[model samples]
Target: MVVFNAPFDITLINAELRRHDLGSLEERLGAETAPVIDPLVLDHSLDRYRRGKRTLSAMTSVYGVTLQEDAHTAQVDVSMMLGVLQEMAVRYPRIAGVDDGALHQFQVEEHRKWADNFGSWLASKGRVDDISRAWPQE
Candidate 1:
């Protein structure tokens, strides 16, 4: 189970979850123990980096997900994670049926597509260490 530490913002978090078919960050409407909130810096004041927290927050909002603010960590089921990825395959036809971008005709290098890809691209180019460094500023 990969602990996805994302940045703040509801849209991005939701997209990430959607990209992987994660239904509602919080399965329970008002469950405190539900692992929904991405374990990342949420409030800017709390974490200046604003990387994982912001990314996770964005994804949550995009999917209308809400977890107890007090519980800022969540576990991702491997099967569910795979399902989410399977759904992502149907999202962009360009990358459909292709896992490693080997079957795509073009390059999917857009930062807004996914926060991790953006950060990964940056790291590949020696711009940032990881997603944590790609957090947007306030």
Candidate 2:
């Protein structure tokens, strides 16, 4: 499955399902979870040089992808994310060439580095002493 931010979306979905006493997608599918392709992570990995915001709207604009409607709603966001990813793949073929396992592993490590760096920065400011070193899920 594809998502703009897998961790956030999955967590929110899981929480809602629990609140409503409904089985999660994982439970219904009889699997832990499907392998997720997060466009946000992929965009960060592909174009580390781009400055300014990295929000879905910003990315869609940068990638020359047009959404059917405004962003924020799940459908629009996912559609735009997929479009951005498609554009990224065309621009950086190597990214799309990576196998799923390798890509997942790379994102895991990249996310860890980002978290660790943020944690250290927060520690310097006395904002946080430590941060959870989890990625994709907690």
Candidate 3:
């Protein structure tokens, strides 16, 4: 499990958008098996500066994460957050990073890992190559 910690609320919003893509465990994993991995808030130290009544600089505070559950414990992985960074880089370059290629690669890797594990699990349960097989291909 990889957890994504953001420096502020805006970043938390960014994280939520990312969750919409990779961690969409609604169908294959089943609602019971999947934890409600949503945007979260927490108390953390922040280094904020005032700029004409607006807060600026390191907005370290609440963050969100996607988690994986085992028989007993849960885990967080930072890799899950790479998608958020990708989305942010489209508009706000500062949210993720300055490098576009790095972000794209991160997203691809994240998707492959997530799909491999989750898809295999779904297939093991005799769900794969079932409903989708009947659909027409273009």
Q: Rate the local accuracy (lDDT) of all candidates.
A: 0.38, 0.76, 0.30
Q: In terms of lDDT, which candidate is stronger, 1 or 3?
A: 1
Model 3 RMSD in angstroms: 17.5
Q: Comparing candidate 1 with candidate 2, which one achieves the higher TM-score?
A: 2
Clashes in each model (backbone N, CA, C under 3 Å)? 27, 0, 9
Residues 28-72 of candidate 3: C-alpha lDDT, one tens digit per residue:
344422111111111111112222321111111112223233211
lDDT digits (tens) for residues 1-138 of candidate 1: 123333344346556766788744444244322222222321222233434535444544422445335433334333333333344344435445543333211221222335565567788888964454332211
Candidate 1 — worst ten consecutive residues by lDDT sum?
A: 103-112
Error of 3 at 93 (Å): 13
Model 3 clash pairs are 1-75, 1-76, 1-77, 2-76, 2-77, 2-78, 3-76, 3-77, 7-59
TM-score list, all predictions = 0.25, 0.84, 0.27
| Model 3 bad stretches (over 4 Å) | 1-95, 129-138
